[model samples]
Target: MPHVNTTIIIGAGIAGVHAAESLRNEGYQGQIMLMDRDSQMPYDRPPLSKEWMKEESDNANILLRNPAIYEKLDIDLKLGVEVTGIDSQRKTLDTKDGSSYEWEKIILATGTSLRTLALVGDDLRGIFYLRKMDDAVAIRDHMQHVKQAVIIGAGFIGAELASTLSEMGIDVTIVERSSYPMENIVGRQASAYFLDLHKRHGVQVITEDAVTQFHGEGKVEEAITAEGRRIPCQAVMIGVGVIPNTEVSVSQLEIDQGYVVNAYGETSVSDIYAAGDCTSWPYQGASIHIEHWDHAVNHAKTVAKNIIHPQSAPYTYTPYFWSDQYHVRFQYFGHAKEWSKTVLRGSAETDAFTIFYLDAQDIVQAAFLANQPKHALPARRLIQQQKPIDTQALADVNIALKKVPRLQGESNTSV
Candidate 1:
């Protein structure tokens, strides 16, 4: 562990803020500097699609911390600053404004950028992507003159936006290339519940179809599907997905799908670490990259501890994430890259169910709970322990999650 007297953290999202806080909390007396390109204070991004977009809330309500809190914490927060280049040899980075800073250690939490559709009329006026607060505000402003909207991609953002727009009395039509919303993550069985939920809310969900082009004079007025189905809409919101922001790395750091890191959040280059959406770390025998809020917070804390204590324990927390759409909350834990079998508890039609995804070895890999958030915590433990489960017991709602039988000598604890 090289001496880290001064630390520089890039990107002021939840991960960076929490990393800075962890350094101070863990008794690191080094000078800390946090920089971000956004001019506004760091705010929560999850609410941008739901609560913040629906209501007129004060900026402070979304802020991760008050402006004065940074001053008290002795954190030099530089907002609206873009880091242009990084020189690993010099242990320094240059900003867009011709400013350079040297540091003993650097942490990258650049997060992600919203993916856009490159159709013929993609540059049209009323199309929007919801990733930041300003984007949400612009969508709300545009909604005043529009009666209908076509949302491309039925991912979490698109689904949440569909629900929000429907609640605001705007007719919403969701166009998805997959068979159902979030099919890749939650699988077909669980996704059907969300499909039904959207239908009940009066939102038209067009599945197994994609928007081939957008047509209008200047602004988006209609979306042309691949099947030649023309749907007229006054506005459009694209939520295909997001790509990790790796431009700031300047081609100097080791990169794969994302910045490659170890279980301790240490990048290939010593004294350099990364967290949040911009990193893919080793977990449960796989190199996985998670873009959820909980992973960001946990990764930051683990990285902070590893920086202060070189021999700190590796990060082993099970990945967790949740989404809110209509009146239901969907929570998931663990990662199931591939599952041989799926065991269901309760009925999806009732909108109250928990799903257990088991791998080929019959070990619980991941679990998804819809409208039943309490099972998330226990499900996480089951994944972490890699406990083999009886399929029948897993499917029985009468058998509590804690009472499920495990393999041989493995014991289940009450959660």
Candidate 2:
């Protein structure tokens, strides 16, 4: 209950940095200390596996604020330091180097880690997982001499890397454990589209496959599947998924798959907050954990506002996400777990389209679009308002998104 003056934030990635900025924007003129395990300034991680792999020089392009901005904002950044433990009672943290710091409030934005494949030969020389800038640089260098690569898992990272390698003239084979790539995400239809995209781009896509063991003497040379099939390759990149980075055991903190928090990003423990991939945020009246870049930024701002001025407003926003693959940009918003209808507004064959998921009452629950971003803005607005729209008007391909009549319903849910 003491006055909060110094706020220490762990992890200097997107969430941490943005939270600091948000705190300043919210008029929190306090002592802000940002720490990171990495030795460099906070840089963008999303581009590491894409543009960074194309040119080694791109590795230096880290997402950061101007150095003068830190001084202007009065933020003390501690790079290359690891937080060992959190003493919630004393409101202090122990650093890995046997140092400690106290704070009136704290925020944990530790993020997540790439899930490693459990198989023999996993520690071989040519086995790799692209999660950091160093990993991408190493993989790009290896690709120069490696003619073939067997990528384990076909999630976003694996699929994007496969596309990048294929563009570089490298023969890439994606060995996915699931029935289809991204089937668990955008559903079977989208997965089929990706399958054809990869195949047309000269990349082999394997499905319903599990790697029994990696076959190599001193270096990774092949991946042996459970079906006795051998995929010959020189390098292996595993992108199964990621796990939340929450190791500190605090009994007062609620945690499900991640740190459970309410709409305001508040934890059960007072003065303690969480955001980014490590926090489970309230969405659609339920706690939903998102690992998207936009969620991290938006959550940081919300947590910052709540921390600085708790009386500002409710933390509410529609969930929106996007990913750039090949020449197409896929964007999605809102939740679709219980939606009953899926309508298309544009032609999927032309690679320019939008899919809207509507509930039984004609309320838009979610909308996904490929290459068409204009509809997403309005779709997000409708979802946030829980607005009911005319089915025919929304489905009409010729009607402009804004031109559609405003949703009218006395039973619309409050955002």
Candidate 3:
């Protein structure tokens, strides 16, 4: 291994913290520093939508590692430091506070930011977007006084937050521009169950309703829909979507909306790697950029290994995502862009079932389920190996999913 003098990682989120830990595990005795623009310690971003947003004190649980771990591991933690620019040729970074640091290698773990809608009254008070700890705190505080919360964009985050607010005795309304919530990720059918779930939980779900503008005096009192319907609410939670945090300063390094990386997390600039939501890399069947929590941790591991071993293993990652909404635990594995055939292994109406998306070849491309994570295990393995299974056995709910035999010795690389 080439000697690395100093390794500096930007953004002390899951990716940065895990990369530092992985390096130490691999016997790297170099100076490791994690920098975050936020003042808090490295923390898990998932809880921002659930626990952290409900109870203010719950932020303690989100820390990636306790303070002792950083001291014990000898990681130089630099919180509240923002990297304003990256100089690839000089192998150095400039911070917003007029400071510069040189690094032997740099890992960009700066995750995505929330993409707010450009509505007419977007600047109105009580209009919020949740993506950071600060955002969560503000939302939580406002929820304590507000009786109703209207969430725009019915994605996972939006849905989860709506469920959370509903559980707290707050009236919640979710407006989705799509025909159904989570259609982009979970497909329209699975998203339909999600809609039913929300309705059962007393959440008013308005699908295919686009918010044209917000209306209020000094604060957001109501949302004006495209169809000219005004929904009354004290606050608006915008969860439209996210965009990669690659800024113009690093544009020369090569980017296709995100920092384009190979299977090894290598950017166009040598010794520069990116992981987490900021990275777009090749996975099992296609090039994808996943924003799930696990991807941030796992991809950071690959980036760390690649930094030490340039010829890193191919990042054949299985796309996985989960959401905690009401009493349902929705989990998905593998990629499902658009399924030609949809098969259900169990029942969705009963709320405990798995949905399988298969291509014309009958190979399972993706699987979705609520409260049935065990079924996801085999599907994940099959997707990783790119193996084909018996379709009849897969679709039978009475049959044990694991009992299905794999077509051995098939050398198909696509899953």
Q: Write one digit per residue (lDDT tens) for candidate 1, span 1-415.
A: 3235788999999999999989888998999999999998999988888887778565679999888888988899999999998888878889999998888989999999988878878888899988887987898889998899999998888999999899989999999998877777888888887888999999999998999998999999999999888999999999999989888774558898789999889998888899888999887777888799999999999999988997486888788899888778889998877788899998887888999888766788889988997787778878878867778988888889888888764432211
State the lDDT at 21 in candidate 2.
87
Worst 10 residues of 3 by lDDT: 406-415
Residue 284, candidate 3: Cα error in Å is 3.3
All candidates in order of TM-score, best leading: 1, 3, 2
| Whole-model lDDT, model 2 | 0.81
Deviating ranges (above 4 Å) for candidate 2: 1-4, 405-412
Clashing pairs in 3: none
TM-score of 1: 0.95
Winner on TM-score between 1 and 2 is 1
| Per-residue lDDT over 1-415 for candidate 3, one digit per residue giving the tens place of the 0 to 100 score | 3235688888788888998899888777888988888998877878888877767447668888998999899889999898888887777788889998888888888888888779898898898998887887788878878888899988888988998899889899999888876676777778889889999999999887788998889889999899887899999999988998887246568787678898888898888888888888886546777788888888899888888888666676787888998788988898767777877887887899888887666677888888997887877876665566777888887778878766644544663
Q: Report per-prediction Cα RMSD to one decimal.
A: 2.6, 2.1, 2.2
TM-score per candidate, in order? 0.95, 0.94, 0.94
Question: What RMSD does model 1 have?
Answer: 2.6
Clashing pairs in 2: 43-63, 44-63
Q: What ranking of all candidate models by lDDT puts the best one first?
A: 1, 3, 2
